[model samples]
Target: MCFLFLFSLPIDTSDRQKSLPYGTDPEYFKMPTRQHLQASSSSKVNTSAKYHEKDDISSDIDNELSVIFRTLQDLRNLKENSTVSPRTEQKSASEKLLKITELQAAIGDLKRRNAKQRIVKMPQKQN
Candidate 1:
């Protein structure tokens, strides 16, 4: 049958001893998950057990991160309605628009300190 399925495919080295290591087979580097994985002969991912893959976001990038938090709370309420109107900051175009409203209120205080930062990822135990 097609020359016994082409002589049953490559099948050599005593039908791959106990798998793994069709490459640097020194008894698959003393296996215990290749005791101390010494990568060299051309790597293929294992950079410290790789895993830091979080960035999906699409739901239209979560409604564009809530329209960039409603355009930084409408430019901090248009810089507190230009410091409650009744202007007169003796021009220089009102001190360069009050230094662009103190740099947009320090970028709305770093988006309110990164909107209360939090990160959690857990899951790893395949030993």
Candidate 2:
């Protein structure tokens, strides 16, 4: 009975632990040294800053956005102040109009091709 009682008690770490061992758990050591997280009456810094602080965007991100904005402005200026002769503009416009007309004609041709047609055929099997 004494031998059974002595042997029944846990001998080593693996025999004792179910999920975690005796020394492996952080809470065991932390509980003794840890102070209460309750807010103090005269705290200088915010306590929430310890856990839930918002991350600041790096200066590199700001610089990248400024560069992208400058590039967009430059492209807008180029589009607004296009340098082309009046004759050249007229020629391009006429070419675009000709292309549009060709597209419209092609659409009409497709519509004609797709027009429904009736077909006469023998009756299907009666069975």
Candidate 3:
């Protein structure tokens, strides 16, 4: 039984020396150098700046939407309260409504574009 067990053991011991620490690959334990750290930090800053810019743009869009909503409410009130109006006033109100609707559509398109850009900018994780 002792002889059989001894025979079952690996005969070659050279492979042991080549084996990495903790039985894993060396690349997994790679240490980041100064240049790599610096580069990564700089990229983080750039990413942060981009995020801030996006936030600013988003806030601006929100503000514009709020203003447009208020204007629409006021227009509705005007249309409801006034029983009679001149032809020019009615035409102008219709034009304002059309312009506001167009602006809303444009803002919607911008929001979609920004969302797409955000998705594209996100990094994929490696297994």
Q: Which candidate achieves the best lDDT against the true structure?
A: 3
> Model 1, 5-93: lDDT tens per residue?
99989857975765665567575466454534545422545443343132222124345556667765764565333564355534534
Clashing residue pairs in candidate 1 (N, C-alpha, C atoms within 3 angstroms): none
Q: What is the overall TM-score of model 1 with all chains considered together?
A: 0.21
lDDT of 2: 0.52
Residue-pair clashes per prediction, in order, are 0, 0, 0
Per-candidate TM vs. native?
0.21, 0.29, 0.36
The sequence of per-residue lDDT tens digits that candidate 3 reaches over residues 9-95 is 977878865776776877777799999999999999999999868755534557676876777787667644365568877787788
Candidate 2, 1-127: lDDT as tens digits? 9999998997777744455554676576454422354335224356556432432212344454465566546544544226988887787668656755765665564444334211113456697
Q: Cα lDDT of all candidates, in order?
A: 0.53, 0.52, 0.76
List CA RMSD, all candidates.
16.8, 24.4, 16.7
- lDDT (0-100) at residue 69 of candidate 3? 78
For candidate 3, the lDDT comes to: 0.76
Ranking by lDDT: 3, 1, 2
Which of 1 and 2 is ahead in TM-score?
Answer: 2
